[model samples]
Target chain A: MKDPLILVIEDEESIRGMLRMALEIAGFECIEADNIQSGHTMIANKRPDLVLLDWMLPGGNGIELLRRLKREDSTKELPVIMLTAKTTEDNMVQGLEVGADDYVTKPFAPRELIARIKALLRRSPGVLQDERMQVGKLILDGESKRIFLGQEILEMGPTEFNLLHFFISHPERAFTRGQLLDRVWGANVYVEERTVDVHIRRLRMALQSASLDYSSIIETVRGTGYRFSSRSVVPAAERFEASGMHSAHWQ
Target chain B: MKDPLILVIEDEESIRGMLRMALEIAGFECIEADNIQSGHTMIANKRPDLVLLDWMLPGGNGIELLRRLKREDSTKELPVIMLTAKTTEDNMVQGLEVGADDYVTKPFAPRELIARIKALLRRSPGVLQDERMQVGKLILDGESKRIFLGQEILEMGPTEFNLLHFFISHPERAFTRGQLLDRVWGANVYVEERTVDVHIRRLRMALQSASLDYSSIIETVRGTGYRFSSRSVVPAAERFEASGMHSAHWQ
Candidate 1:
């Protein structure tokens, strides 16, 4: 997918230029708004996917504009990151409380800012939101946020759910740990790559709990990460038929 | 840790009573304030870890109180999740724009509220805040938000940093995927258990990036999840000495 368009609302030409250069380098489309008046108009007219707002702009307090944007339904769900020179907890908390998804202090690293922007864009609704997708009997219902294996509900955490959902959506493609982390955990969020292994184990365990052997559909590429395979596997149910030994117990 | 105290600010007696029962059942201590005046005073005096705020109140709007709270440093960072009967997108947006952490509609499930509370509590800055901890040459400097391998800086994502930090904090103890999620990812956030593994791999990769042979510190428990070993291992630096090959390429 092409990078989402980012609206930059800042009074300072230098900072706005810096942001534009950084965002464009990250492959995102950018639109500039010099002050709150222009920012509001730009938002209403352009309807950018995400916004990078200045906390203090010429003519008005940047926060009031944020409140106005959030108070309206049309602009309410828009992901916004507040850029400010203020480092006080009062301002940071107020900005966040006022619905800013992220608050970055001025003179911030462009790399980190781009990373934060990407992360927020990914978290925005409808990006990862998808209707139910099925691989074998394992069903991921996105609307209700539930997973089902045939008649039984498969209990798993949100990370596992998203991971499974991502895998199932792109069935049969092998994803390395780095790609999975960026797609699943997000770029700004950090954790060990091995964490992927842990969540996968839990996913398989959930499948086991439902008394299903559909876990084999999520194949492990020997040297790399994992893949959700659409192809048929030697049915584990048939393989262990005589033992009647449940994989759930083993997990 | 003991369950954190939660203050429920609502005008309705029945809803407050329901909240009290649910919170008490979940082992959380509860306090209630029926009006904006009392709610403000209760927050100031009681200093609860989390607040369940009602949107509309008897004397004034509840969102005004939220704005006031967010506007102050003393009350700021005190997690507040809005409880509202109003299901309008405008109300939700305004409440959130005013800085309410999570907004829940009336007749909501108590279980979901508690989950959200736990998640928000875990996300609060101080809960996981700790001074730097060192395991060998690796240092997780909390204040600087940087990791150091000997004199070299280690680059990693926040999740990997936290996972490593958490592991280093409680070395040698095995923690299940559920425990890790609660402590590291926060409760409401979801992902697969195998995600833990993927993160671990990523963590090791980070260590490799620093040219460190410390990957052996994190060990996967046979039956459950993972553990960080504080004990000495036959240093791989010595084991593969003849090859003169760095582990970075292997990862």
Candidate 2:
């Protein structure tokens, strides 16, 4: 798959530079614009996967652009994260009511920004494409909240399905039990990381019943966290080709 | 300085274990309490620098403990970060209204937790003592929003003052431009991370006029970000002694 493209629209050259560097390093293609005129043109032309928009911009107000984007069907569904210095609750509500998918205040940790971007991207149409995703003969029907192996349905809890869905959608990456809780269980839900281990066991058992061996697929990095691999497991040789999965071992 | 002690008030062993591992690795002392009864006792006896609280407990609700802590003069100023599975707006409002220093949703990245922990610790009474902080000859008065070298006030912009205040409160720490923006600028603002450099430069210039060569204090961490050091910087030994700052590189 091609790298996801993100549009960074801000008035500050230094901030734009920082975003460009950070986004590219995080494996996303970035296009920059310093003002609303260019921002609108870029959105209309490049059609980015997501936008990192500044609340205060030159030539136009960010909230106004957000309103326009939401008003027009062509851009309405585009995922956006408003970058603003405003920290008040009223400001956040206004931004959300105007249809921002997320909010990252000024001076945000690049990792936080990247996390929010990744989360928003996961929900974007380009990534979701459809409600169903297939890997090998295994199928995940998100719309129906069901997993299928060939024609047979796999019985699992909603949490297991959500966990599997997240893994499949974001394969070849390690997720800390914490990240799993945030991504699969929703950020605010206070489930234990061991709860992740329990669910992983259940998921593997369910997949095993369907003649799939998860012991190799959901590889656990000792003392670090868990990861989802698309490649065959059990042998050290196959692991070399799946190097990307190890990149996030710090998780 | 001794490592800050953090009390983990949570019931889940797995989550508590994760917090312990993460906290100890980050150079902080941690004490775990599974219930509010023990939690209150720990607070009274141990008097930790901060608290990583779980919203739900076996015997008492986390919010109840928060209210009780805030109401009492002894613990009222204690900084608490509520770990919750509750992400609803009303829930957050309630948590904040009850006086949680911050909030970290469940399934948080270890780095995110550490960041909030560090930020809250910086605000805790033991650290702040007063609205003022002293480092060498520099005096940062939070209430007045002013910095003084001995007796004279240093001239700077609001952003520069905020940046300096954060650096003073969190000395011997290296923070990336993104982290600086998040910490100093307020996370939601869409300012460029490089804007940090501009304010930093301005701050340095202002400090230099007071005969303080900030080039040594605000050391650049080649390919990483920036750090504010208390020790003299020309030698490699001081850098090793100042290593505590790197614990937050993951942020």
Candidate 3:
């Protein structure tokens, strides 16, 4: 297989050369850009597998470049790892909030840099060559952008499908509305959190058509946000086995 | 720095010896246990930085071992990685479901194993060395498992504390009920899925005592699950944002 491509956007010639050499040694094809303009141009033309973005650039700053990449439909899904000198918590939050997949501080070890790249690549959806995702009776085909519940295809809007896609891929963590917005909506756009509610409702309705137990599957966290659980709604038989028939485990 | 202590629980003598040598080379102090009973005792006494558990054992399975570790208060925080020959889909889900922080299929390279060990340690609360988790005014002490809103301490149960701990540790990204159960409850217990709902309610009540805006913090996904967010619940924000926003941007 051909080596995965990496786009490095940095102004410093020395740093750029160093990163190119390191990535090349690690079996990645390198595309270097001296500034944000060239970076965007390369991004538009080359569409590299991943982008190693510098936080600061001459005209459009890295944050601005990140915003534009996330805004556009074609590039929104591209994985980005920010390379920055700013290691403060606030800057980290802003970088993450802006949709950078992961970040590394300047003066990082080459080994650490390579490890992060490999980890990010492994986690990216593009790395999974499988065109379909299947769990239990549910199936999601990335190629067709279709979902199948058992044998029957389930029809859902783009938003609901994307929501389901995220949930299925990373199951078992409660996500707040803000997080959903940041991930699903992209970091650049500002939107109402409640809109998450409308889309969630639509997604559930779509799942219901397959006769699945959508209610118990997507559990409400009351004051928290939402979680998708494959746990049975009924307390498992084991609970009864553990708690003697006399004392009530439920208060 | 003193080497981080690691407990290796496996039946095979050769594998155990190999792991012991490799871990020592990787700057970790090692403790060995052949059976589940002995492993539990070693865990109680040593309180190792991490547990490398073999999935198949002569006396008991690794899933059960993980369950017992997570149930107890003292050892519950310990990170575990399962080493196994079984690479089936069901096994992966089951291992993860049973609270194995990570799993490595057998015949694995030592480097990959060590990398995973280091990665888990880095993410672990104790190992991360970050004492507090704070989102806005809400603060959680990882070492003490205490919640403080401003200056006042918030009262909570072990389960609620764990729930809050997981939520704060991973902000954003909605988790479903099954995932929460596997994570917070550990994989072995068969409690009512709705029990998560009850605990969430109790947690909210505790947060309310501090007069913190806990209500808006945990958002209900209606049919999906729960998420903890810092976003405001104002309806006007939703109307204004949703009108022009793309459906994908809900979080």
Interface RMSD of each: 14.3, 18.1, 17.7
* Candidate 1 total steric clashes: 55
| Candidate 3 lDDT by residue in tens digits, A1-251 | 24578999998754675576557545578999989999999999997889999998898789889988888999988889898877788867888898998899875555577778867776665553224655455667776789887677888899888788766654444555655654455432335567888888888778754466443555544434566544333245533442242211111
Model 3 Cα lDDT, one tens digit per residue, B1-251? 24678999999999999999899898888999998999989988877889999999878887888878766778766878899897776676566555566778998888778867765564343334225666655777643345767666676766787898787666555778878898888865688888888888888788764355565677777777788765543245543553343211212
Alpha-carbon shift of residue A70 in model 3 (angstroms) = 26
lDDT of 3 at A6: 96
For candidate 3, the per-residue lDDT at B80 reads 86
Write the number of the candidate with greater lDDT, choosing between 2 and 3.
Answer: 2
The total number of steric clashes, by the backbone 3 Å criterion, in model 3 comes to: 37
Indicate the residue-level lDDT of A37 in model 2.
91
Leading candidate by TM-score: 2
Instruction: Quote the positional error of residue A107 for candidate 2 in Å.
Output: 16
CAPRI classification of candidate 2: incorrect
Give lDDT tens digits, candidate 2, residues A1-251: 35589999998754675576557545578999999999999999999999999999878799999999999999998999999877888878999999999998865666678878878886765454235665555667765678777677888887788778777766655555666665565433445457789998888777654465544567664433676765544345544533444311211
TM-score of 1: 0.38
lDDT of each: 0.73, 0.73, 0.71
Worst 10 residues of 3 chain A by lDDT: A242-251
Question: In candidate 3, which residue ranges exceed 4 Å CA deviation?
Answer: A1-49, A52-130, A232-251, B1-251
* Deviation of model 2 at A118, angstroms: 10
Show the lowest summed lDDT stretch of 10 residues, model 1 chain B.
B242-251
Q: Estimate each model's TM-score.
A: 0.38, 0.39, 0.31
